[model samples]
Target: MIGICKSFGANKVLGGVNLHVRPGEVHALMGENGAGKSTLMNILTGIHRADAGTIMVDGKEVTFKNNKDAEEHGIAFIHQELNIWPNLSVLENLFLMNQPKTRFGTIDFKKMREMAEAKCQEIGIDLPLDEIAGECSVGQQQMTEITRSLMLDAKTVIMDEPTAALTERETDRLFEVMKKLKNKGVSIIYISHRMEEVFANCDTITVMRDGQTISSRPTEETNMDQIVGDMVGRIMSEYYPARTNVPGDEIFRVEGFTQPGVFRDISFNLRKGEILGVAGLMGAGRTEIMRAIFGVDPHESGKLYFEGKEIHIKNPRDAIRHGFGFITENRKTEGLILDFSIERNIALPSEERLAQSHVINDKKEFDFSSELSKRLGVKAQDINLPASTLSGGNQQKVVIAKWVGMHPKLLILDEPTRGIDIGAKKDIYDLMNELTAKGVSIIMVSSELPEVIGMSDRILVIHEGRAAGIVEHKDATQTRIMTLATGGE
Candidate 1:
């Protein structure tokens, strides 16, 4: 990494950026979600410092005064939000901040569980070193934070979107532990927005646009439409829109839905200008059927409807007075309230829609949160800052413009562009085709699968919460939605 300029004040997020990784190949870097690839990996792990650039390492010229001086020069990282510490253990999160001592000074727990069970068997990470890293699964707490950065022998690791919440058999055991850390020569870097995990496990790639360094090639001659036409100069067919449909009636239904250990017999319907995607695999309940249809879990058995009536949502303020709006899938911990702003989290469900009818209109809630924050462009430096200071693709467009100023006819969303990037996933697929051309009615919940086969018109899939069938968005097929999202052939 060299000349990696950065800025937040005037927002030049890493403009002079340049990077190179080699030692034993991998490279990657990529772009799109707020470009600048996590500000050049938080300035190569010193956790933000480069107001300019120059880092070097192995060729020497380094500077990381933090992240334990970039893990004592071998560098480390992991982080696409998994920082670990879920009530510890997995051998205390693989040696919490480099432990191991005891010449009677104590704290070496049998040489850190014999080096975290021999570095979780040299990274194939099958778990169980005294368990409880929050009792596992989020792809085993992201491979125990990448096996606690190779038990501190790191040598340039990095990672970031490590299989955006995994499971294709846990991302083929993390590409067989990145091919045994590139046959032990080490280097990595990686970071991704998933062009099939940088063309199946990078051997170079780079890209990064808007914040500079437009190309770096050689993943066998760069392709994925030339790294998305050099990271969004366009041409990926104007960034995916096609999934057309014209269904209308049904509105929203869900019969027989149970929520026992999490799911069972769930059903579906969702029409009236529909979208519907859903697909599954990670705990296959597809975020517990959008948290049991937005009432936030309370489905011991179910049936819900709208156009044909039958409602009783019972909680998220009776599913926002039966209009419903969800968006969830961890947009900064269950969708924003982050120190509030961006027009006070887009005027908070208009405070129970104006404290239960009439009289709380601060200029019509700042003109309806400045007209849905300029119809969802939402950059920042106004609408009152905070929302934990924007940019994770503008904090996921302020969590879909905080439920699009709560108008909702039936939105639901869930994994809305999960870890964001491809130019903020094409401005969230042009704000879901302008909220399905304003008639509204979405349902989405996705684990990518080509974005539920490029924005559904009826896909469904699900598996352990039942309805494993639905298809027809022109007879979909990511191998038939991975054989109905894992119930298989």
Candidate 2:
């Protein structure tokens, strides 16, 4: 992308944004939320057209009329959100657009399978030739996505948060594959909010802030703190603040938490002023346990104790009745109603607090949402603006603020800071510390190991639906956590 300019109505999301990639290099796009990184990629991949720009592909300038044109031009964009159909077989999803067959009205299953097998072999994926895509794990699904791009001869592959849902070993495998691609002269444009990944795997780095390119430099020439400072143009003094409150009596406890084929025999406690962390790989039962506790998922056997008495939470309503709140992992879908106003989405769970005469109190609703929005530092055009219009980091803050207004005795956040920029992450860490200081016990589930170590007073490590081990604040080592996470415990 060079001299790119794009606007959504009056908002100039991309203003003269410029990026480039070499034939055998990984170019990383780093930015705070809403820095026009996605917008620029959208333009390049024909998801959106630039107001004015020129794209140089292999020393030739090109313009794509649409996504199909971009694909034909040898560019493939894997969105931050996975787009594969779960119910379809892997072969079908791989050759989704155009299938190989003889010139006949009937489908060609034999030739399609043959070609899919060849492609999967070249890409090092070992999924069954006819395995259902949905039944596979997230890491396998991502590999399918990558193989799909290669089958189309996508010379320049663009991956957006491809490893966000992957395990440590899976991430290592992905990096290895990317290195092979680099050696084969396949340029990759990697976009991610994870600074460590960018620094580790990318050759060049470009930082964007507020729809502008802040800086672009060679990875070896810059450090993490400098790049972070450039991305948000600030020096973050402290990330996770020290908690001020004393740990009180246990506010919530779960014993014998069990969900058939998911997780079983789990027990944990949340003190009134403690931040308890849950750490594990993807599908390791961290999220499952949280969902079961919050009554979002089914539980065959478990005992949930709130305050002191055991409560049977048949649904989310019962969880709420027991003063429970959850911030889901999939923020775009599970957390917020995108089309609704930020204020409206934030006020959704708290409507009962302001209802009078079988009617919602609009004034109180707006007031509460507005106050929380301000307190959480949610960046938005207005409270009435649609939640979809906000940036990723701001949207996350809105989600947190929504539940904070509910005043739950226990709040559970699953991957609360995924895909958010470092500045916003520090802000969130500060917010978490503040919440814990106020006697609001927190149960946070995060895959980022550093965050698990930094924020939690204690951590519960799970694997294959069982509690592997537990560690205190200062004693948890990444090596120890990984051992238990991979089933060593």
Off by over 4 Å in 2: 128-136, 382-392
Please, what are the lDDT tens digits per residue for candidate 2 over residues 1-489? 788999878877888988878898899988877788888888898888889889998888888888888999889987776677889998888888777767786668888888888876766557665789888776677777877877777788899888887777778878888898899888899989887889899999989898888898999999888887888788655556665667788988889988888888998888887889999888788887888888788989878888888889889998887778899997877899999999999998888887898699889988999999998888777899999888767888999998888988889999999877787788888887887778889999999988988888889999889988889987989998889888886
lDDT of 1 by residue, 1-489 (tens): 778787878867776888888887888888776677877887888888988778888777878877888888788888787777888777788778568899988797988888777777766557877878877777788877777787788777888888888877878888888888788989888877878877977898888887888889889986787788788787675557774547667877888878787788887788776888888788877887787778877787788878887887857878988778898876776788778777878778766665535566676677878888887777676887778777666777878887877878888887788777777777777777677777788888888878877778878888876778889887898998888777876
- Cα RMSD, model 2: 2.1
Give the number of colliding residue pairs in candidate 2. 0
> Which residue pairs in candidate 2 have backbone atoms (N, alpha carbon, C) closer than 3 angstroms, thus clashing?
none
lDDT of each: 0.79, 0.85
**How many backbone collisions does model 1 have?**
4
Write down the worst ten-residue block by lDDT for model 2.
Answer: 236-245
